[model samples]
Target: MPAGTPDILACLKGRFIGIEVKKPKGGIVSPLQKLKIKQIQNAGGIAFVANSLEVVKRELSEHNLI
Candidate 1:
């Protein structure tokens, strides 16, 4: 598997989704992480770093990905 890949990968509402899980506090995204997320987005996919379940819900809802 590729390094820095998201923890969760799935198709939601006909869209490719990637979600990287992190700590609720003091979570840091490395440069590699930024690159990986950008790669997914560059391919017209949905990707996000979520520190909590609520954040995941918000991202999906806000983007209408679900």
Candidate 2:
């Protein structure tokens, strides 16, 4: 995650990407966060909740952003 925020930003060959890292156990996504991610997606950007390296890779790959 980035400083003072729950999100980390990245770029995959110029495409914007945002990651929200969460715990692996019983983690929940808040409504506000969901709205934010939805905005990213609406803008053709990628957004995900990654709890591990594997999850990060999966999300990127799933979005064809990696």
Candidate 3:
């Protein structure tokens, strides 16, 4: 397993997806989490920080994975 992995992981249409979920208003992303997200993006994957289903959906939509 990769260290500092995001809360959610999946692959859609040959693209990697990583999502870090938090409370709608109070969740904080740690440094390690940021690094993980960056790593995923740098590797040509999609990464997002989401606090709700809506946020996740939006990110997916932006990536055309939904």
Candidate 4:
């Protein structure tokens, strides 16, 4: 994977998805990670940082992917 690549990458309903997984506690998103997320979003992909399965589900649902 390239620098700052998201932890999970997938294609759901034809949409590109990128998810960065972190611990529920003491998890931080670095500047590079933030930049990558933004880049993915700017390129019309769904990208975010998730600390739990609920967050991942919510994000996917928000994008109508679930």
Best by TM-score: 4
Regions of model 1 farther than 4 Å from truth: none
TM-score, every prediction: 0.89, 0.80, 0.91, 0.96
Considering every candidate listed, which one attains the maximal lDDT?
A: 4
At residue 29, candidate 2 shows an lDDT of: 79
Off by over 4 Å in 2: 1-6
RMSD values for the candidates in order, in angstroms, are 1.1, 2.9, 1.2, 0.6
lDDT of 4 by residue, 1-66 (tens): 998999999998999999999999999999999999999999999999999999998998988878
In candidate 3, residue 32 scores what lDDT?
A: 91
Better model by lDDT: candidate 2 vs candidate 3: 3
- The residue-by-residue lDDT of candidate 1 on 1-66, one tens digit each, is 688898899998789998989999999988888888899999999899999999999989988865
Backbone clashes counted, model 1: 0
Look at candidate 2 and give me any clashing residue pairs: none
Worst 10 residues of 4 by lDDT: 57-66
Worst 10 residues of 1 by lDDT: 57-66
lDDT of each: 0.90, 0.77, 0.90, 0.95
Judge candidate 2 at residue 45 and give its lDDT.
Answer: 84
Output the lDDT of residue 50, model 3.
Answer: 93
Ranking by lDDT: 4, 3, 1, 2
Query: What would the TM-score be for candidate 4 when compared with the true structure?
Result: 0.96
